[model samples]
Target: MGNEDFKQDKLIPIAQRSFASYEEMYRIVDFLNKTLKEKYNIMFGLTKNNKDGSMVITIYEF
Candidate 1:
């Protein structure tokens, strides 16, 4: 639909975690995303904190 129909509240962060390496964090996020995206309408995100080298995982409700 349109941007007006988009609800910011629906896209919320439900959980978060920090990891030492991207590979390990990515694996878990990727698996959860693949398994939960359709049935649960949930998604996972990965990013690096600018101040630190650790990888960050954010679980979201879609």
Candidate 2:
């Protein structure tokens, strides 16, 4: 590693949140999983929960 190769740029990290209602969340999750399953034939789903009042969703495969 050379010192010249280490260049620091101004790239600020941002936290992204999906602020969707219960119905919208369900639709998005279902559509994504179904489309992916039918098209790519990958079996998976989106799991969601509330942690500290923040909604978090994760993709998992069985």
Candidate 3:
């Protein structure tokens, strides 16, 4: 992608949290994504931390 497409203001990581299991993280992120995505312009993502194997939830603003 070009520099303009990778602007810092485009995607911002606002918050993050660690969970014990994928099920727990998925539930919370799914709920937040559905409830807040349209009205708040926010998104939630889930990933596993490679180092510790913990579930990570990331809150992003777009």
Summarize candidate 3's per-residue lDDT along 1-62 as a digit string, tens digits.
87535543587899998867665667877888889877988888799988888888888887
In TM-score terms, candidate 2 sits at: 0.39
lDDT at position 22, candidate 3: 62
lDDT of 1 by residue, 1-62 (tens): 65424633477899998877665777887898889877887788899877878888888886
Q: Candidate 3: give the clashing pairs.
A: none
Pick by TM-score: which candidate is best?
Answer: 1
In model 1, the runs with Cα more than 4 Å from the true position are: 2-9
Relative to the unseen true structure, what is the C-alpha lDDT of residue 40 in candidate 1, on a scale of 0 to 100? 82
1-62: candidate 2 lDDT, tens digit per residue: 55322321222223234444364566776777668744543332333445544344554332
Whose TM-score is higher: candidate 2's or candidate 3's?
A: 3
What overall lDDT goes with each candidate model? 0.78, 0.45, 0.78
Sorted on TM-score, best first, the list reads 1, 3, 2
lDDT of 2 at 7: 20
